[model samples]
Every structure is written in C-alpha cells, then in structure tokens.
Target: MTQLPLLEQAILVLAALTLLASFSMLAQSRLTSAIHSFAWQGVMVAAATALVAAVGHAHHLYLSALLTFSLKGLLIPWMLHRLVRRLNMEREVENIAHPALVVLAGALLVILAYWIALPIERLELASTRNIIAISLAIVLLGLWLMIARRQVVTQVLGFMSMENGLFLAAVASTRGMPLVVELGIAFDVLVAAVLFGVFFFHIHESIESLDTGKLTRLTEEEPA
Candidate 1:
C-alpha cells in the first residue's frame, strides 16, 4: 500500500467498496435496503472510474463516471424507490433458503474468480488487474443472490449488481470503453429499467403478488 501511488491506492479502495456493496446487497433482506446498497455500489464504481481516468489520462472516462453516478447511483435508485412505494413492497423481505450456505457459496465463488483471472492478471500491465478478479466475483455473487432469493425486486437488484460487475471489469481491464458505447449501454440500462417497471405493474395486477416463484405455479383453472 505504501509503495503504490495515491491514485492506484484510491482505485483499489473504491474497488473494495464496490465488492463490499455487492456483499451488502446479497445479505440484505429488505427490497428498499438492497436498492440502497446497489446505489452505493454505483457510487463506488463511478469514483473508481474517475480515479482510473485520472491515472490513465482518459478524459472520456470522466463523462462515463458522471453518467454512471447519475444513472445507476441516483436515477435508477429513485425510480426503484418509487416503484417500491407504488407496489407497497417497501417492507417486503426476501426469503432465502439457507442464508449461511449462500454466503459461503459466494466466498467460494470469489476464490474461483481469482483462479480464473490468474492468467489475465499476470499479463495485464496495470495496477487494476486484481480488481478484475474482484469484479468477476461480484458478478457471480450477484447471480447467486438472484438464484437464492425469492423476491422480484431482489432479483432485479441482483441483475443490476451483475451489470455493475461487468462494467467494473471492463474499466479495470481495458481502462474504459469508447464513449459512444458507454452512452449506448447507459441508455439501454435506463430503457430496461423502465420496461421492468412496467412489467412489475402488470405482474402485480394479474397475480396480486410479485413473487416470481408463483409464476411457475400458475394453472389454467386459476384466474391470472
């Protein structure tokens, strides 16, 4: 830590924060709290991107960071908060089978991610190589959360977290992508969120519940 430059060290710290936020989201039971954790993770991603931009002298990354902060950190979260309020799901708790087992599985995934990234980490000539592994772990953990939790909103949170991990991995490994591509991705995420919000309404109206497990149990005799 002492030998590393200030910017590199800051980037590492922010990456760690992002990983911690991923874990927090996975562990959280309430929809509202998990959304908040996702927002904080976005903030960490933006900060890390900005720090990398400073280190690599990539001006476009600054814009990317701003976009990430606005879209993921603020806009999406605000939108989800409104959705929660409208759906009356603010206090809804996710039902996870064997919470401790889930956490242990997540830890094992981190080890697997580290092993998978070993070859790339060795060849990468950047200080952010280790972050790539962390990002992959985050991705897997988010997926695990989606599979283990039995709540619609929590699944959405997991999806968003997985996207975050992908973004982090790209930035760490490639020092950010083209601005046009980033803009497209940002727009796509916003559009997807809107569509998901609309689907939430229809799902709630038809089934009077947001639990996705119920979808599989629907019968022709029962009214949707």
Candidate 2:
C-alpha cells in the first residue's frame, strides 16, 4: 500500500476533528456551547482547506480558507454570541427530547453517508474521497440537528453548519469554488445571520420565547 503524504494525513485528521465537532454541537444542550463547537468546526474546516491547498497547490483554496475562518469561524460565532446575550438566552439549556436516541440516529447517518460515498471512493478520483464521506456525514448531521432541536437559534446553528459541510465538500472534492462564488455565499450567510437576529427579536417580542413549536401555535390563533 502506498503511504499517504504527511500533509494529506494532517488533512484527514482535521477532517475527522471537524466531524467530531459536528457531533459535539449535536450533543450540546447549552446554546453557547453549541455555538462554540460550531466555531471550532469552522476552524478545523479552514485548516483542512489550507492543507488541501498546500497538497494540491491550489492557491485559491488558501483564500477560501481565510474567508471560511473569517466568516464561519470568527464573525458568525461572534454575531451569535451577541445575539444570545441580547436575547437573554446566554444561560438557556435546550433539552433534547431523547438525547441517546438522537445520538444513535446521528451515528446511523454517518454510516449511511459512508455507504453512499463508496462508489465515488472506488473511482479514486482524489485523496480527499474519504473526506467527502465525512463531509456528507457532517451535512446529514446538520440536517439531523435541525430536526432534533426545537430552539430557533439552534436550528439556525444547524443551518450554518450545513453550509460548513457544503464548503468542506467543495474543498475536498474540487479544491474549492471560484472566489466569486465563495464571496457570494459568505455575503448571503451574513445577511441571513442579520435577518435571523431580527427574526429572533420579533419572535421573542411576539411570544417571549424562542421555541419553534410556538410558531405553529401562533398560526392557529387568528390575529385580533
């Protein structure tokens, strides 16, 4: 068996850490802790992108890594922290309906992701194929997070995490998207964050709660 290069090994390690971070975010009950986990996941993804850039000699990916670190790693998390404080949800703990069961479901999703990626892996298109599986797992896990969690803020975290997964997949599979595309994505995400912050305030003002379940109840009652 041919040995993987040292940089590729490091990239794989970082990819695994990124997946672990996704799991951490899923299992986290506290809103702040989950956001922190998400930030670290972004950092790991950035590191992996940088390593991929180094391995593939794709200079554009280096810029992608910087953009990811700036937007996903630092700016988004900082914005979320401020939102949590402003919304007075800094100490809020979301109780997962069945924590163990949800974790088991997440594990199943990971396995399924690997299974789905097997054919692509056979092609041996790139050293990052395994990371593609991991990226799919991250995406599935993010979707699962959105389904399992009830808090609007947590759901938003899941949504952003899904974006991270997509970004990682692009880097792993194709070395990175065009600079213009990445910039567009970053801008859209920032606007979404700001809009979500506004939505949180509106929800809080309307019902004094951030639980999404309440939104359903809201529609049932006719406005006065």
In terms of TM-score, the best-performing candidate is 2
- The local distance difference test score of model 2 is 0.92
Tell me the spans in candidate 1 whose CA falls farther than 4 Å from its real position.
219-224
Each candidate's number of clashing pairs is 0, 0
The digit string of per-residue lDDT tens for model 2 on 1-224 reads 99999999999999999999999989999999999999999999999999999999999989989989999999999999999999889999997898999988999999999999899899988887888899999999999999999999889999999999998999998888899999999899999999999999998999888998777774656566
TM-score of 1: 0.94
The segments of candidate 2 whose C-alpha lies over 4 angstroms from its true place after superposition are 218-224
Which candidate number would show the highest lDDT if scored against the true structure? 2
Q: Which ten residues in a row are the worst by lDDT in model 1?
A: 215-224
TM-scores of the models, in the order given: 0.94, 0.95
**Stretch of 10 with least lDDT, candidate 2:** 215-224
Output the lDDT of residue 166, model 2: 91
Q: How many angstroms is residue 20 displaced in model 1 relative to the true structure, after the best TM-score fit?
A: 0.9
Write candidate 1's Cα lDDT for 78-196 as tens digits: 99999999999888887777777878888899999999999988895687889999999989988988888878788888888898999999898799999999999999989988988
